[model samples]
Target: MNICVYCGSSLGKNEKIKEQAISLGELMCKRGHHLVYGGASRGIMGVLADSVMQNGGEVVGVIPKNLFKKEVAHKGITELITVDGMHQRKSIMADRADAFLALPGGFGTLEELFEIITWNQIGIISKPVVVYNLNGYFDSLIQMIDHAVDVGFIKPGNRKILRVAETLEDCMKFCEQEL
Candidate 1:
């Protein structure tokens, strides 16, 4: 299966989160799954891609042309695809991936995760969306989703679209079930 991971372009201050990203990459490789992600050679994105490659896993990078020009694109990935813009990049990544997972990140990561979830909600895609909420990183976000459901802003059934996993093991388990 091709698993698409949306993560930070910069590694956060926490060492454990970085380690978790590495572990997640290693797990994907060990499980013989291919990785599809934003093609950048910085932050958690770089670490995850490098770990997967080191473990002999196939990685497909979908980077926007602008970022590629900025020289943040991963040159060592199994395959690197450059798109014209962010929307095109996301479309190609979504098309290439069988499942989606989100790691700790800032606005970009949240945006990608929410976009994928929204796509699934609107029937644009039915792939599974998993969020790796390491150390309660996404606790508040999850609570907000629950609040949305309570206020009738979101359907109760739609809340299940985003599966929250606290560890790499849990994420892998969800992937296995979904795929």
Candidate 2:
């Protein structure tokens, strides 16, 4: 499977979260899955890519020209595709991925996650979207989603579009069901 991962460019202060990224990469390799992600050689992104590479897994990085220098596009990945901008980058990533996995991240990551989910919801894509809630990182977001469902802002069936997992194995299980 080719899994697109949405994660932070900065390695946050939480060591455990960084560890989860590393473990996820290693597990991806073990399961013979390719990684599709933003091409950044810094923070959790870098750590994840390096782990996959070190474990001999294919990694296809999509990076925009604007962030090439700022995010330090990873040159050591299996394949690095450069795009004109963020929109192009995301389009390429989503097109190439079989599933989407969201890790702990800030604004950009959240944006990517929602955009992909919206696309899936509208029939632009039909793919599994898993949220790796490592250490309850996404508890608040999950609650907000529930609140939305309760308030009738979102349909309960639509809420099933997202699958939350606590471990890489669990996340993989959700992705594997797409097969």
Number of the predicted model whose TM-score against the real structure is largest: 2
Residue 108 in candidate 1, Cα distance off native in Å: 0.8
Give one digit per residue, the lDDT tens place, for model 1 in 57-168: 9999999988885749999999999989999999999999999999989998999999999999999999989999899999999999999999999998999889999889
Best by lDDT: 2
lDDT of 2 by residue, 96-135 (tens): 9999999999999999999988888888999999999998
Clashing pairs for predicted structure model 1, backbone only: none
Global Cα lDDT for candidate 1: 0.91
Off by over 4 Å in 2: none
CA shift of 41, model 1, Å: 0.9
CA lDDT of each prediction against the hidden true structure: 0.91, 0.92
Residue 3 in model 2: lDDT? 94
